[model samples]
Target: MRTRRRFLIAALAAGTAFALAGCETLNTVTGLLGNQLNFTQPQLQRYLNHSFPREFDKLGGLVSATLTNPRLSIPSGDNRLRLDFDIGVSALGARDVSRGHFALASRLRYNPATQGLHLDNPEILAVDVPGAGSLLSGGTRELVNTVLVEYARNEPVYRIDSDVLNRLPSGKRIGATDIEDGRVVVRLQ
Candidate 1:
């Protein structure tokens, strides 16, 4: 009986050690795959701005809204960008065809694992709609950002080249991000 108990305890200890070693190996693998990365402003604009119309369309569809003509711009001397778009909001099951010009101001963020850029703290900076006036002006700003943007939770606003993204995994991490003079500078690793 004594010998059997000793064997059981030894087996349990060995199993625990193996599990810890597996975790350590996983960490090492992550470290090997990670890297430091950088993205220029022009590079960002080429990809981000060009793709805005399609991506914004997806974002609007999440809340049953229609977004068109998304234009991305970085204001001079500001650490944020404005996403100007035409939005058609439909509510009340009947789907009213409300359309207007709108702008969203957002700060930028990054995720190392995916090597993707994210727009954070999006706010409606401007809105123009005929006849409706200010009634729908401020009400849907927060809701559009928080509820309609389902892609933001898991997806990056934009991703780097796959080769670069794979290199900058979570193991090393994103170091810094700076937006200046119509450029986005990102430091990774």
Candidate 2:
């Protein structure tokens, strides 16, 4: 009888262990099925890299500017994304181009219909032209803002995959998007 009781005790312990393990597995699976989609900084940078070297002509094509080498970063403690670019400016007929650096920060706006992320409320952080101090301070700032607005309106920084969205449960969709923990997060609801 003692031997039989020992065997029953072992079986009970084994069953409890299996039940605990099953609960853990279920928790992990539900976590994976949660309503969050994350895009890392490198992924976003890859998309932005393909949209670079945008050229703009103003003043009836007399003044021209080219924005290239887009570098993206998320500033600590801030919810905005920053983009730094190499800017080249020149007259329409001039061979000499003034080189500068352009920095801008903006919030991310996601359009569910288009599955695209756009730069929202972009503002110029800095416009640095080495050895040409204050050269791009006033009128040039306005011109850069114009180019920024145009770029923000027409170009999407990154696009969400429709296939991924389609896999979500029916009637659920992305409700909010933000820059968090150095990642672009799309929260579904």
Candidate 3:
């Protein structure tokens, strides 16, 4: 009886050690595979889609615009993302709403404080207000530009949760963000 009890304790100890070693090996493998996170074009598009339609009021509520139907794409080898969306503008209590299309192109930048990706150096490619030929001129264009600036500065295009980062080993954090093969790849270290 005494020998059986000693053997049982030894066996339990060995099993516990083996389980710990297996966990260590698993951790190493997870670290290797978790070095990067890939976000495809469709995933990015979905994120942007859910974020709109963003509404803005300018000129002391005289001009109001809503941005909707966001279409996002990551062009191959371009290292930039493009967003094309529809805009509806109403002015001075007018019942008629002017519809337009706006295309914006920008590079992506990572914000450490937010643990998210934001638009960087955004440039307006096109602003087409159909039937309103000169709408992209002067005040209208400036208002649109102002709205874009606010979006780029304040809103994150893609957010990385802390729990996701916690999956990495200690001392590892996102190191770089790049576009490759029409996907956004976030690399960690």
Candidate 4:
């Protein structure tokens, strides 16, 4: 009886640990802006298929319009959309902000009758600003906000509310220019 009790306790502990470890794998937008965005293969695939392209058209277009030679490309995939683009900020006279890369994993949705496109849960996995060096932090929020606002105006399907933006760490007004990197990241999700 004593041996059986000990074995049951050991098994319960092991099982608890395994369950907790699995929970850690769930990824959220908060994780990405914090540079902690991690997703399982299936989660990543779902994000790519449902949310990527619309995000690309909205945010990606802003980045493209604001910068120079902003190349956007979507590669074909079985389940989701994969895109890689490069933009130079020099055209805006902010040479320091001119060079960056944006990568997106997302999926596409369409309404046959309306011929409309919808993207869901698209994640901006990486944004690399090589030229601005540290200054990238200064304008990252402005850039992100600009994209978000543009998204709101152009894409009715994207449900970004001012309340959600206000819930972000900065707590600054949605259009406020004081925003920095961490604030921008927190709102990205």
Candidate 5:
């Protein structure tokens, strides 16, 4: 009886260790980068590596953008803008693709001549990767390009109230916002 109890304890300990080892694999280095904006190039690369193909199908094209003026203000500032847009996908792969419904809040620098707010950087405002295994499979570059083009065309056009916005340099917002609708159409090569 005594030996059985000791064996049971040892087995439990071994199982715990194995479980921990498996968890380590899922510890994507991306997590260490955190959701802060102002990411290092490598950090940004990692985010784009995982994010683009996962969200979009094609690699190039202008995604449309719509700007919404703010009705209220946070302590950050009043020159905030809300952006809404979508990127087109040629093939969403066997897995499910999330309906593109993401928003990014940006601190805009207005160009008086252009009458537009410029995105200072590529900090992700929000993302909606619906579920696991939902990836664009034709090729990684193709998938990434699709999302990037959409992102480039639909750049945010408003300054965000930093107080409500997650200050993390790479923070990705998960909820929906009020902004005009836009679309990205992808063409196959």
Candidate 6:
């Protein structure tokens, strides 16, 4: 009888552990079954890495700003996507060229009203202009923000189709999002 009890306990523990795994594998599988995104890390990375550049170009959001070496990392202990990309800027009215970079770290949450993921507190984490140390007078970050705002004003970063948006309850929304153990997990109602 004691051995049977032990076996039951062991099975329960294992089930709980798998349910609480840090990756989105299980979540993605369940999500897909429920008509939601199968948000695995590789899939998310590939889609974002491909889509963002084109969106940026279409918006003409960043004036004379060209992006390269775009990379995305899921930092530990943070429920946000950390995006890093190198930029080329036409300085001095396009006469001189400069190189810089930007980082966007923000919390991901779903807004039921829109039924879309929202990037909270998005900002440019860093900017380094080569050979133009004092030109902007420490306002490089500010410029980056301005450019981002323009892009956001015109289009959302990620959005679900209207048909799907209409199905979700307006008052119910995702409570949290996290990327850990190589998975993107978003809490859904």
- TM-score of every model? 0.58, 0.74, 0.73, 0.33, 0.29, 0.58
| Candidate 4 local distance difference test against the native | 0.41
Better of 1 and 4 by TM-score: 1
Cα displacement (angstroms), candidate 4, residue 175, comes to: 35
Residue 16: error of model 4 in Å?
63
**Model 4 alpha-carbon miss at residue 181, Å:** 37
Between the candidate structures 2 and 3, which one is better when assessed by TM-score?
2
Best by TM-score: 2
Compared with the true structure, what per-residue lDDT tens digits does model 6 show for residues 65-161? 5666667777766666777777665544446657777788765556656555556667667777675444344355655676566543443335544
lDDT of each: 0.59, 0.77, 0.77, 0.41, 0.35, 0.57
lDDT of 3 by residue, 1-189 (tens): 999999999999999999976664454345447787777676677668788889988777877778899999887778889989898877775667889888988888888887778988889998887643333334556777888888888888877656666667678777778777787777887
Question: Which residue pairs show collisions in model 4?
Answer: 48-106, 48-107, 49-106, 49-107, 49-108, 50-107, 50-120, 51-119, 51-120, 89-98
- Candidate scoring better on lDDT of 1 and 4: 1
Residue lDDT tens for model 4, 132-170:
434444455345445544543344222232443344444
Q: Residue 17 error for model 5, in Å?
A: 69
Clashes of each: 3, 0, 0, 10, 15, 1
lDDT digits (tens) for residues 76-130 of candidate 1: 9988877777766544343355677778877667866766787776777876644
lDDT of 4 at 48: 32
Query: What is the Å distance of residue 121 in model 4 from its true position?
Result: 2.0
How displaced is residue 169 in candidate 4, in Å?
49
Candidate 2 residue-wise lDDT at 52: 80
Candidate 4, residue 131: how far the Cα is off, in Å: 3.1
